[model samples]
Target chain A: MIDNLLFLAAPITVSIILAGILSYLGNHILTRGIIFVDIAVAQIAALGTMIGLLLGFAEESANVKMISYIFTIAVISIFALTKFKKQVISQEAIIGIIYCLALGTAMLLAERIPGGSNFISKTITGNLLWVTWKSVLSCLIMFILIGIIHVIFRRHFIKISDSKNGLPYSLWKTRAYELLFYITFSMVIVKAVPIGGVFFVFTLLIAPAAAATLFTDSWKKRLIWSWIIGITGAIAGMYLSFTMNISNAPAIVTLLGLIVFLFAFIKLATKRIVSHNLSKEKGS
Target chain B: MTGLEFMFAPLVASLLLIFITVYFGIHVIEREIIFIDIALAQIAALGSAVSLVIKNISGEAAGHDHDSRTLLAYLFCVGAAFLFTILKNKKIRIPLEAVIGIAYAVATTSAVIILDKGAGSDVHIHDMLTGSILWVTWPQIIRLSVVVVLTGGFHYIFRERFRKVTLSYHGVDTGLKNPKLWDFIFYMTFGIVIVEAVNIGGILTIFAFLIIPSSISALFAKRWTTRILIGFLVGGISTLLGLYLSWNMDIPCSPAIILFLGAGLLVAVGLRAINKLFSHQRQSR
Candidate 1:
């Protein structure tokens, strides 16, 4: 068992790193109320990689990165344009449309390429067991860089996401900050999607933060709780994956999802118990 | 068979899809639970995956057990709908839409985990997304039609109740008797339709069929009947055009349908924008 864990050490470490940073970003996304934006952005970036592969570029080549960057730019532009003041339609509607479009287009392109279905399947669940220590090092470096940028502009990012801040939704400065945020977000997704796959990335990005929200409203406390929940879930998921002989990405996601569901139930039970005590005290 | 004859089954399948999906789409939009269809579809897919996993462990011939998988898928969809109904009254701090979105993510990943235990996970996952509309046969279309007619009859009988429940989203309670009961019925029927729709059209195509036609019709019409009519018109045209393109160009049918619906949505949005601009100018005058 120890030898098996040692063999699995690199993937476990990468998952831990992913859970930490992705949990932070998930908090931001939950606050923003655009929950599926990560899924949309990740799928579109994968589509860009598909485009590169269609043109005969290798998976992790510079040309693939460039194509993904262009797709990111296009998506950012769409988000900015669709952030209207009067809002003829909901932003969620637009996001849904874009997600389907990207997915459909990717499927079309995949049909023409060799091993395209396998490529997509990998993008969805990822190949976490095959990740090497060298790629883990690169992933860590990229996350640190993005983390620093978010830290430097923490206030602006938080304020813009706060819906009741009384600021107009369509300001030029808001657009610029939104663009900055999405650019960095896409950068993380470009890195994370390859490592964790779309499903695992989304789970890490939403589940921990959601669980944290059940216990507190303060952002700092939520971040701390989110990190704790995420790290714990990651370790448990890795253990489960190793012992059960299953794949990593889906196992981690299922564990994290169960954790969030369990937290919600715990919150409900406590609330009920406290209410019951209060009623008894009133009767006395 | 000739090319046009070959395209006929898919065309009937797409039109039959509009018959059920567009109506639920109106209710979905009215309630603004836009992602529910996709979420429910994912849950349904998860259901099939679980059954497949069970079959694998039981050491059976899993490939031939289509009926059990379909039955399990229906159970999952209705069960999710029941869960959503219960959760709505619990009034958790998070938005229901957000909860639905979370369910979507988790269910999708769970399916991934289960399907991985079986062979051909890649092809199965890809088919769940894009679907194989081009290869649909007459038997499938006929089976779908029977369910469609039954669901349509149920809705027609309870039309006023369903409308009342949907309008209650805007706080207009027109004597809704047992709102929870009505809500379940609506969702149960909705879930049933989604299981069949997802089987035929995949996740993306069905979503477009659900949202785009109703959204476009909503841009022009006010009354429920008018909106349904407009939705039918838009969807019918898009299906014909999309299937024609798929037949001639040999692209996948589901995506082609989605792209054409997307194009229709764009045109509708543009027309709405132009209409707004003219009205604003007139107000200024």
Candidate 2:
């Protein structure tokens, strides 16, 4: 039992860290009008997977190696688009388009490849039970790299997120913030793609961060709470799925929903209780 | 008659559905309820999934087997749509997006589990995702055409009233004052859009035929007539192009159509920017 728990440490730790990064990124992206970027990136990554399957890169082939390359390219494309000022379309609209196109391409490609239909299905839905030791290691390494970059560029990120107020400051450090933001977002897409597939990654990237924003005003607190909720949700979800023999991705999403629901309820109840207590105090 | 012959009904049904959806989507855009479409789409998806589960429990195959099951699915969808509209009108404290997302997630999961256990491998969930537009027949198409015509006629008859309600803040007050008239128009439009969208995979249809084109047209055209005409042109061209692309490339039609619209928006933006740049440079010179 102890050995089993130890074996699970890597996924748990990686999930916690990845969740934090995703949540932070999601919140900032939502505010920036690029809320659909997460979904688009995930879909693009899945498209890449379909391309891999078509090119005979099955479980045994070099297809797995290409996941990172495809993910990186997709992330860079999105980052570059978001950086443009005279964008004719909203980022959300562009992202939505990219998502559909990528998924369509994947479907078309899957129809051509032998036994590719199964791969397409798995890519969309995902199978957490099949996660290998290699996947776990990859996730950990990516998580550490992202966490380090985030720490190193925390000040710059904060400035960018506060661009409205940091207009003067940004004039001096303009490229720095953009570069950091792009790199962090790229890392997020890369790490999230393989682990959760598209759907779970999209949800994890946005929902927890959005939930955390409701409870805290400060970026620091928001990031902290977002990370806590994300990790707890992942671990709890995985455990429940394991016991219940259900798919981990959907279970994790359901867990996130439950967490958000609980938080909202608690906040509402607390407000009511506080008002009641204040009224009684005044009466006394 | 071959399997191809059988596909005619769905194909025609989907085309009619597309027309009605595009018309309603114009209103959805004008009202700035873009996210509301997403919410309704998710609700419809959930409703369909639940209906599928119900059908499976009764020992029926998931698709195209029984007309009654399909009817049940539409009923469920309309019911869900009504509930969503009511909740939205009431201004419930819950964030509509969250509620819709959760409902969508639950519905999708339930649908998958039920289908997986019941039908095994022959049934594809992608059928639900992509829709069966290829299978629509002539009679089905005719039925859809009638709905579109009637709905369009009704909108024309009440055009001024709707414009007032939509364009003015006072419209809501007027609506409250004459509840029955406004309610009738509102429900008619709502029910028509829901029915048509259900025929075309809900949000995909609305997004492609209505929201994207209307938004793009609104960006360039100041007058409502120009906006509507431009929207119709963009939508019709994109739909034709999307269908052709899907047929040739063996891709899904709906997403292809949306991508075309997105590309159109990009081109429009590019043109506006170039025009602005040239004017600025000319002025400077």
* Native interface contact recovery, all models: 0.45, 0.12
Q: What is the TM-score of chain A alone in each candidate?
A: 0.91, 0.75
| lDDT of residue B232 for candidate 2 | 73
Tens-digit per-residue lDDT, A1-284, candidate 2: 68856756655655665676677776676445455565556556556666665566666356654763566475555555454433334444545545555655565566687766565455445434456677767776776787787788777676665553224243435555665676567666755665665556766766677578667767778778877888888889878766776656667876786566566656666777998999999999
**Candidate 2, chain A: TM-score?**
0.75
In terms of docking quality, model 2 is incorrect
Best by TM-score: 1
Tens digits of per-residue lDDT for model 1 on A1-284? 68887888998899899988999988888877677787778778878888888888887799988987797778767785666544445566667778777887887888988887665565665668778999999999998998999999988888877763344445777778878888888788778887777777888888888888777888899999999989898888888877787776777778887776666767777878999999999999
lDDT per residue (tens digit) for residues B1-285 in model 2: 464455445445555555566566556555444444544444455455566677778887657654565465556556545544433332233333444444445445544444443221223234445555655556656666776787778887876676655554223554334543554456445655665554555355555565677667756875666777777777777766776677667676766766777788778768777988999999999
lDDT of 1 by residue, B87-179 (tens): 553434444566677787778766756666522245234557767788888898998999899999899998999999888766685888898
